[model samples]
Target: MVRGKTEMKRIENTTSRQVTFSKRRGGLLKKAFELSVLCDAEVALIIFSSKGKLYEFSNSSINKTIERYQRSVNEMGIGQKTTSQDNLQHLKEEANYMSEKIELLEASKRRLLGDSLESYTIDELQEVENQLEQSLSKIRATKTQLFKERIRQLKEEEKILAIENAKLREKWDEMQSTQKEIVEVETELFIGLPQPRTTR
Candidate 1:
């Protein structure tokens, strides 16, 4: 009698999980080796254990195989890939589109700079003029914003300086009053002194 298929789930027991991992890893490596030998094909396999231990198999250098795979995937797009000839044609079309875009941009730049306008239709010239006007408006708005910010900063600084100046003036006035009081006391003491009696 055929045995039922094992229901795959996470092995809850730690010991069982390690044992399963070891068995499966060996089985997988064996299959990979067998496939490479039987088919005479390049093969690379990499597996990482739960503890991050690396298990790998390669018929040839794994790096070379990885590079070859990457080149194949990129040069011919994945999933029922087109031929190299098709890829070349697609690239040629893309290049042509890019060249056209570059040419258009150069023409627009020339028109914007007031260098070449003879070939442009009226509509094209109008479009270029609109772009220039929008750019100028944005620049003017930015300049105004910067000036306002500067004015705000300067006002803030002026107010701070004004408050500091007021504090210094109050200190100076207090010092002056103290000096005047000291001088007045000294003057009173000098004037209130008694004269010594003269002998004949």
Candidate 2:
């Protein structure tokens, strides 16, 4: 049978917990040594027992390896700070671009609405007039489309109403024929004899 995965929590029993730590520590040290030899790499391992006993392993001097690690970490911090400054600069530039674009659009809108025309040249005024004419054309086209759609909807409604009226007229004719038959029977009963059939 396959072994189940061990839970990643503290071993509750004191003796079992201690034994597990000792076994894992030894295995870790052995693995570190093998990795250093196989890869010809600078490897290090450090461990402290629960009772404050120290254990360590290193392919080079442990103090020297630790110093090198510290210097590398400091250099990484500097690089990250520089990257952060670059990101800040990029965001500032993007904000400036958006601000300029917004100002341009606002200016265009003011010109379209005839709010600020004192600074415009004759050519610019002509351009604005052309833009307004194009805008009006588009608006008229949209209005025409809506009118056509409404007409189509009304025609469809009219057809449906005509069908309903025809049905009502047919039902009325049926009822009138039934009433005529009933009246003829009543008249015959009142006369106490059947009348000769005649077209009504």
Candidate 3:
């Protein structure tokens, strides 16, 4: 059976707690040394006991490792700041593009609705009219296609229904013929296991 999780709290008695802390501190140092040797990592660990006694472990110079950590953290902060600035710039450009596109679409919509045609040249007005006619033609063609598709679907459904109805009718006829045969058998007279001899 799998072992259940044990609840962990602090060791309450002073002697037990101190002993536990000393054992754990030794284990932690051993683990840190193993990690550095096995993984080729620069490891550092520092522990202070309740009596203000210091315990320390390091695979390399602890000062050098601390400096390296600080340098890495600073570089990460700088890289993040640069990335954030780039993202902000990209967002601003996208917003501008969207704004311009919206304005163009709104102006085109106004022209299509015959609301903003006062500024258009004759050629531009003719072009807009042609666009409207083309759009209307495409819409009508699409509508016609949908109606044809619907008609096809209805015909297929009707054919299936007719086939089903024919099958039902055949079953019904078979049932009626069976019932008639039963009635004819029941109506016969002199029903017995042996046949009777004819009289002279």
Candidate 1's residue-wise lDDT over 19-39, tens digit each? 989999999999999999999
lDDT of 3 by residue, 1-200 (tens): 99897459877899989988988898999999999999999898989998899999989899988897787688788874447776798699979999999999999999899996888999999999999999999999999999999999999999999999999999999999999998788555675688778999
Residue pairs that clash (backbone atoms under 3 angstroms), model 2? none
Off by over 4 Å in 3: 1-94, 186-200
Q: Is candidate 2 or candidate 3 better by lDDT?
A: 2
lDDT of 2 at 92: 100
lDDT of 3: 0.90
TM-score of each: 0.49, 0.53, 0.45
**Top-TM-score candidate index:** 2
Model 1 per-residue lDDT at 40: 98
Instruction: Arrange candidates by TM-score, descending.
Output: 2, 1, 3
Per-residue lDDT value at 108 in model 1: 71
Candidate 2: TM-score? 0.53
